[model samples]
Target: MSSATSLPIIFVEEGALAAANLSAAHRAWADANGFTGQRGRLLALPDPQGGLAGHLFGTGPVADRPPLVAAQAGAVIGPGQFHFQGASGDPTLAALGFRLGAYRFDRYRAGKPAPVLDLPAGADADEVDRLVSGAALARDLINTPANDLGPDALDQTIRSFAADRGMECRAIVGDDLLAAGFPMIHAVGRASAQAPRLLDLTWGNPDDPKVTLVGKGVTFDTGGLDIKPASGMLLMKKDMGGAANVLGLAHAIVSAKLRLRLRVLIPVVENAISGTSFRPSDVLTSRKGLTVEIGNTDAEGRLILADALALADEESPALLLDMATLTGAARVALGPELPPLYSTDDELARALMAAGTASDDPLWQMPLWSPYDAMMSSKVADVNNAGTGGFAGSVTAALFLRRFVDNAAAWVHLDIFGWAPEARLARSQGGTDQGIRAVYGVLKQRYPAA
Candidate 1:
């Protein structure tokens, strides 16, 4: 079995026999072994001592995979110092996936976690440092179960993160929630002993291009009055995935010091059942003074996020982004690997798509279709908590939140799985940072100076 170590890998390509000359040790070996060098294949090369010269992996024609491909490749490669020698054999993907694959939830134990992969040849030292640090930070946040990662825990994490970078950090907890005028956030999280909190961290000069990030931080969701079944609750630990992803994005932004002024808003809560828990059909007023009729208590992620997004939009940040594990329909539409994104700006959508493709964090654009607006219309209030039958659950959810951000210049809503369902080459099954790298790429490219 391969242990966590750096391993060198190379790519092999097929060429014309009589038309071209191929004389490298790799090509010679491939010819003899009948290895056509297809995509994502790995073959062991000779070390002469046979101890392991390196890895000869195929990535089809160009020998390139998305950065997300790093997960599976990292999983299969030997865990020691190794680098890629073939086409674009830079260690970016390997390092990205290696850090991601190394994630594990061992919070209860005293055991030390996996060590960081030392950079191999061809890996950009600075880039590897930034990505690995961010990936590790995201994994640490996700791997912690709800038991220890409740609202207050997330608050502390964000505080430390902000302080480390010399950014401003503030959190509104419990009764302070009422004082802060975030009544909805207070109502949703009041049931849990852990006080519900809204964490805000801002970096960069106020004059810079404004970028706002909002993440759903439901530390655990028990469906409130509309409780989920046992199987559904099994993975409730990952309910804070959106929050984890935001931290991932923040890490990248701060590490690279992207030119834009970045602001992060996370509403941390645990949708627990208690005598004080809000019930279905109960009316609650948000920070913006819009009364929301809770149609289904299980649809709580949006509730908490509403207050955060309103807070974010109040500034009319140049870019407003909120990410959440908001709907099952999104997963059904795009599966776990591809996240569904809702946006009004076509150019922004294009940029996000291109960034997703280039970074290997692919995103699919789903319309905030105006027609679906009627589906969420509530008789008594501005909007219903959920759709009547859940035909376009993702669309309806995005529409619901859309009401809160009318003030923002540009807005994006990501309904992401944030968890990998199974392990593929360079990816593993568990709490994953879905669509994170792509968003980072998009934001950094749009505003490159920091």
Candidate 2:
């Protein structure tokens, strides 16, 4: 429907409910239904003829308003083209939220039809499309079970993604990873029936400022010899959420045609239990030539990421970012909704935090805590894959990856849960995207289109 005729969604703040410019009859209807302007509350307004006219939505206080509050409206509104009136907050984010709320994982079941939202004025349609598509891609990849998305299958997905985008893609699979000087990746992934692989996807101008992304792609973490309990194993399928999120971010960057060289390195593996599983106390050499002792086999994400980050650091990319579902300690520290971000550059950290706040993809900066680096020291090897003590698990893991990234100009590591324990605003209950939008925002700001 045209903007002039589209259903209007009138936003009302908490205290301003009495001042909302509603007609006498509609005001009576709202009063009769007790439609106070509380956040996430929606009351459909009826016309004189009793047909649907518009909607009255509560947005709460300005400080308490969520970036995706419009998502709630999208969820309940019937299938019709709608436009916002008296909308608060960033109009672009509200439009994005509406689109995100329409997302559903229908791979195995029927999904509901999404109500259309008229593009808000000043919102870029391309930007919204890129963000939505990227997020959907990440969510889909994370939600899929390991049986359907192992190392080899992930390899195919990356290949197809590259091919579709005209990007160059390659992989070092199985024993080739050993030949390619990625022993740690090989060791961690060698136990699975599906061979471990390192996926490389490159795009943008070669001579442009380099930005590299390294993501942990443990398709499923059975936790190998240091196995997890049945309860801990339930969500292991989402372990590859890092790879999925990187792919999503890459999609946005590439789609926007950002003027920078981009490289994505994913160490795809399945840490499964088998006779060949790398055992605890086994020392393995990484791509950077540092020997790492496996303090716990469950600490395999850092091992694989070590090799990938080492490779990315070789070029000394202007920005090096890695994402991983690496440590449960991160979840313990920040809960499932917030991811911990560790960065060598304070300026970059600030920019990312600002961007995250702006995009509603929040990140909490956690220190590399140089003092904690000693926790990863090992007598048998150069470093231990897992920290000596149980304390500072996420910090130690980030420090472990830091060892292989000396050459990079600036490096950041995100310890993301990559799954939503429950539904919130625009986020669904299952596998979700974290930190990508924040990173994407930084990239867009740093490398604007020429």
Candidate 3:
């Protein structure tokens, strides 16, 4: 939680000797000091008193891919105020690069020593605030184990976050879920002692355009009766990634003080196997009144999201967005770097795509075709939680959720991995921030303050 990690970050470009244009001072330093400009090279310049003077890092000498300049020093660098001591006065590019380089998630253990970064002079304080806080929350949530981060803990985190912001919060827990008409949420969460609940928090003026955000909060996944292998269960603690992402997104929205009224909904549960666990053959009625046949006991994310999305739909919000680590198929299709986005509005889709590109948060849009509608067919219930054939599993899931939302002017569903496949500079190999920036960009432009 260091406020400003202002560490000096000077970049040395490689191949100066081979190039035609080179400064004598820069060339002299490079040749004498053996500065090859290889990525992530850390060199410290000390003062006359044997203290630190400034720090230097190596950046790959690619002209086209300048944004990735900070990839070398991101999370790997220790906490401090980082500065680009290079001659390039491109502060915006420097800030963008440094911001991308400063992310880290050391939840399993304490993060080792890395230089703190100093914020750039006149950096976008608001944007930086949202990015760091939201990303930290996401990482913490994804890094904890299921035993520690179950339904109750997830709800508690949300309550704590809401209270910190002075936002109003309400939760429908246990059988109260049934009484409150969140049967699916209960059915999915009822298996755990943590007791499933639908958490709703409101912020901003009541009369403002409602912007309801929903996230799947499955704290762990045993895959229910279907039970995944040990390898699959290893990372199941991150099943609540949807909830984490939503709360993370809400953190950004609230911190930025966006114009739209905000509401956050998280249906917290652990899809553990027990006699009480909902069965694959069983059918359950959702809050939206659509009866869903449980196609697979493990397909529990949709169950919780169904109840929450229905509630969001009821608000008739100006915009509705839901994020989940819902399918491996999506990961197979897009890998961990890009999340597949499903949206009903074309303009919104374009805007979000542009926003993602501009903000370094990339998302690819998948169609919400009506033809895939029948993939979720069920003989007894209105639909099955999963499609019979898994050809387009991600699309079918989106189709299943679409049943509950017909009124939202702009609705977007993000099937996010929430975990990075490998280390990518600021994005360490652990829990990662997928769409927070792109969504923030879109929201900022949509409701720019008057």
**Model 3, 285-369: lDDT tens per residue?**
9998889989898888988898889988986899999999999989888888889999999899889999887666889999888
Higher-ranked by lDDT: 1 or 2: 2
Cα lDDT of candidate 1 equals 0.78
lDDT of 1 at 62: 49
TM-score for candidate 2, residues paired by index: 0.96
Q: In candidate 2, what are the lDDT values of residues 369-398, reduced to their tens digit? A: 899988888898898888876999999888
lDDT of 1 by residue, 1-450 (tens): 123554556555544221223347656776677666565566766755767666665555544544545454456655456544445344676666656655555667754445445555566666666766675666667767887788877888889888988889988788898898898888889999898989989998788989999999998999998999998888788888888888888888888888989899999998999999998888889988889998999999999899999999898888999889988889888888888988978799889988888766789898988798788778898788888866989999999999889878889999988776777544456677776777888877788862
Question: For this target, which candidate reaches the highest lDDT against the unseen true structure?
Answer: 2
TM-score of each: 0.89, 0.96, 0.91
Better of 2 and 3 by lDDT: 2
Q: How would you order the candidates by lDDT, starting with the best?
A: 2, 3, 1
Structure candidate 2, residue pairs in collision: none
Count of clashing residue pairs in every prediction: 22, 0, 31
Off by over 4 Å in 3: 1-7, 13-29, 32-55, 58-63, 66-68, 79-81, 87-93, 96-100
